[model samples]
Target: MTPAARHAAAIGILDRWLAGEAAEKALTNWARTNRYAGSGDRAAIRDIVFQSIRCRRSFAHLSGAETGRGLILGALRAAQTDPATVFTGDRFAPAPLTDAEFATETALPPAPSGNVALDCPDWLRPLLDRALGDQALAVLEALRHRAPVFLRVNSLRATVDQAVAALQAEGIDTRPAPLSPRALEVTGNARRVQTSAAFAAGLVELQDAASQAVVDLLPLTAGARVLDLCAGGGGKSLAMAARMSLQIFAHDIDAGRLSDLPARAGRAGAPLHLLDDAEGPERMAPFDLVLADAPCSGSGSWRRAPEAKWRLTAERLTQLCAIQDSILTRAAALVAPGGVLAYATCSLLEDENSDRIAAFLDRHPDWRCDLSRQFTPLDGADGFFAAILRRVD
Candidate 1:
């Protein structure tokens, strides 16, 4: 498809997304219906859709409207591209800009600062400010762009150097991420990772560098019994297994999320025992370490899931906090005497990170937090928080 055709397609998908359909769903539906759109076309369209969403507020401001056309036009202007190039009303291109649109696009003033400029929702601004202070705007600004792809060298199968060599052989260039020794930030040809020989042989797995850093910080030991309390997809569980010889068990409240973990573990050659909703937590009590990668507003990962920031509500955040509290309480009970409970979230909000740790300590005097750390995009990774709490007699 022509570049103009791709933009037109992105406009339609963005319109469906604006109408309340999920961006991914709209893209999938569009792809399925337009079977003739090649892989390149689909990828190009998807990039346009996600980029538009990532900078939605600023785009809206630039175009003076929140519609799909406005966002695409704004995107083009942001790239310093001529709107007339794609909005040419040529075959398979978006309709020509109206005189009013032309005026808006040409005479567009600089976007207002703060929330809109950062693409941060108004209600979330105070929360971010309180949590990040001077870095709030920088963090939000980072979210307005795409996140880099990171891979964790599965040490159980390959050394970091070995993984790098194998990936390089496949035309995927990577450089070590300073956040974690095992992390490789994919520099080029990231789209071919899944098909690369290294990935098929379990030499590397798609994981964020911050996530690898979090796992690296956990209190792990060889032959220890570990429980991943909320091990959705078991990314951390596999990472743990690769880090040391651990008898790791995975469980999630929603069993469906664990359905693919077994195959993933098999591929990585990381042995992981699975627990179903009816079975784990109580029956498998007294684990040496329990990791609750709790669910949150996902604010730290807005770069990857931009719509989540726009969709988050105060009520929903409150509910999530309550659920996090409940998970802490229940997971604590499953900890062995003197074992550790690792609480983590992909959120930059204090209400979800340190505040939750404080509340847990206040309620449980017998336990003490050993370490707490927050990772932000400034650290070359997504925002992540992890705290280690140890039980004492």
Candidate 2:
């Protein structure tokens, strides 16, 4: 498809998204209906739609409207492109700009200010400010763009150097990420990573560098008994297995998330025991390490899931915090005497990170936090928070 047609397609998808359809679902529905569109066309349209969502408020202010057309116009203006080229009223392109639309463009309003300019929700600004402080704007600005792709080298299958060589042979270039020794930041042809020999050979897995860094910090010993309390997809469980000889048991409230773990673990040569919610905690009790990778607002990952940023509400955040609290409380029980209880979240909010840890420490006077870290976009990885607490008595 032509570039103009892609933009037009993106506008339609955006309209569907604005009308309460999910971004992914709207894009999927469009793709299914428009079977003539090629992979490249679909990817381009998806990018345009996500980018517009990432800066929805600023784009709306710039285009003097909040419609799909306005967002596309604003996107073109932001890119310093001539919107007339795309909105040519051609057969496949968007309709020509009206007199009012042209006037709005000519008399573009002054730039947005504060939260709007930063592409943050007004209600979320204070929370982000409190969490990020001086780095708030930088982090928020980072979310307005695409996130970097990172892969974790599975040491069980191949060394970092071997994995790099294998990936390079497949035309996918990667460089070491400072955040974690086992991480490789894909530098080129990242789209081909899944098909690369390195990935097929189980030498690498798609995981955020910061997420790997969280596992790197864990104090694991050979043959350590570990429990991943909220092991969604078992990413951390795999990472831990790669690092050392671990009797790893993975569990999630929703057992369906762990359905693929057997295949993934087999591919990576990592052995993981799956557990059901009814008896997993009791059977796996007294573990040396228990990781609670709890759910949150996903604020740190807004760049990849931009729609989540706009959809999150104060009520939802409050509910998530409550859930995090409950998970921490329950997971603490499964930790053996002197064992470590790790709390983690993919969020930059203090309420979900540091504050939650503080609350946990208060409730469990015998357990003390030993280490805590927060990873942000500034760290060149998705934002993450992890804290290790140890039982004293």
Clashing pairs in 2: none
lDDT of 1 by residue, 147-211 (tens): 99999999989899999999999999999999999999999999899989999999999999999
**TM-score (C-alpha, index-matched) for candidate 2:** 0.98
Question: What is the Å distance of residue 302 in model 2 from its true position?
Answer: 0.6
The sequence of per-residue lDDT tens digits that candidate 2 reaches over residues 1-393 is: 999999999999999999999999999999999999998898889999999999999888888879898999988888879889999999889999999988876887787888888889999999999999999989999999999999999999999999999999889999999999999999999889987777877999999999999999898989989999999999999999999999999999899999989998999999999999667777769899999999999999999999999999999999999999999998999988778899999999999999999988899898898999999999999999999999876
Query: Lowest summed lDDT over 10 consecutive residues: which window, candidate 2?
Result: 277-286
Error of 2 at 124 (Å): 1.0
